[model samples]
Target: MPHSFALQRSSVHSTAFRRLAWGLLVASWACALVSIGLSLARWAAIGHAMDWGRWLPVTVVPAQAMVAGVVAPATMDTAWRWLGVALECIPGLALLYTVLCVHRICRAFLRGEVFGPEVVRGFRGVGWGFLAMFVASLVYQVGVSALLSWLASGQKAGMVVLGVSSFEMSVVVVGLMMLLLAHVLAEGSRLKAESDAFV
Candidate 1:
């Protein structure tokens, strides 16, 4: 495991953790919407003789494929720019779905529905969503690189890189761990049901 996987009790109080989770859920949705809106706006800007020199700050949410500061190439055509935007939105959409799954899990926790079937399903959803996000990220990275390389074909200063990043690998591992945890939760729920039946 690339990360130190520990389920330590939150140093902050449980109430604080709950509050934070709720805040994160809201913020994640807001960011997802903003990312989509920004992509649409950028797509609209493609053919308007927009100034690519003045780099606009892109709002990047966590787990998104595109990090901040990747400026649009001046020589990039409208079609390629649109393609890049579409690819970049893949991770954003994935992250949004993942975050919503996490939010469902958190809501169950707040309701004291731990070890229930719903929570287990929520965990499974999160695990699958995380894996999907990672896969989409790989596609986004490769596609954007290819798009940029094509755009800069006539230029001597163009650069393109293709490699598996450690961050991406870590996310894959985390997804696996989440799936494992989901299995554990399912088993626990089953055992709890059996015990209740005996009582």
Candidate 2:
């Protein structure tokens, strides 16, 4: 197992990994751009066909509580809309940072850095990036809630603008798992190096 990374760089697996990495890199960036574009579009449509909270989170105070077809009226105030946009974009910013880390890892894999310090760092970066997104999402929840409620236009008393989702929890779980995997891989890589040096 210590010699696992001793495989030839030009092997089939390396070729496949490089190709996949390239594909993932392109796809991730494209998706991020598209998502941002859509968010902006939604922001522009705030007062028109869509409610201000359409793109933003509109949910109940407790995540378990369910409200159907609840629409918070469009707040025409520029400051309120801008505040909502800022809150909504926080999670997106964190996601973009996470994708940036993924890009780094993909690049490393493309260069045949199957196991090394660079790869380790890349994994760690992504792991922490996801955790950052998790936190940002929580902030978005509170901020969006306050923004939507402060306007007090057709908003229910107990209604909330933002609430936690399974997706956010999943991201955190995946982030922690990634970190664990990174730690294990780092130790394994270190051991392999030590064994090779001894040999």
Best by TM-score: 2
Minimum summed lDDT over a 10-residue window in model 2 is located at 59-68
Candidate 2 lDDT tens digits, 1-199 = 4355445545625667678888999998998888766655554455444245677653222122223223344544676567666765887898798788888888878776667787788788889988998898778666655554544445435345556678889989999988997898799779868987988
Model 1 C-alpha lDDT versus the unseen true structure: 0.68
Q: Candidate 1 residues 126-153, lDDT tens each?
A: 8988899888877876666555544545
Q: Give the clashing pairs for model 2.
A: 57-161
lDDT of 1 at 58: 45
Q: Give TM-scores for every candidate, taking all chains together and pairing residue i with residue i.
A: 0.68, 0.76
C-alpha lDDT of candidate 2 relative to the true structure? 0.69
Q: Where is model 1 poorest over a 10-residue stretch in terms of lDDT?
A: 1-10
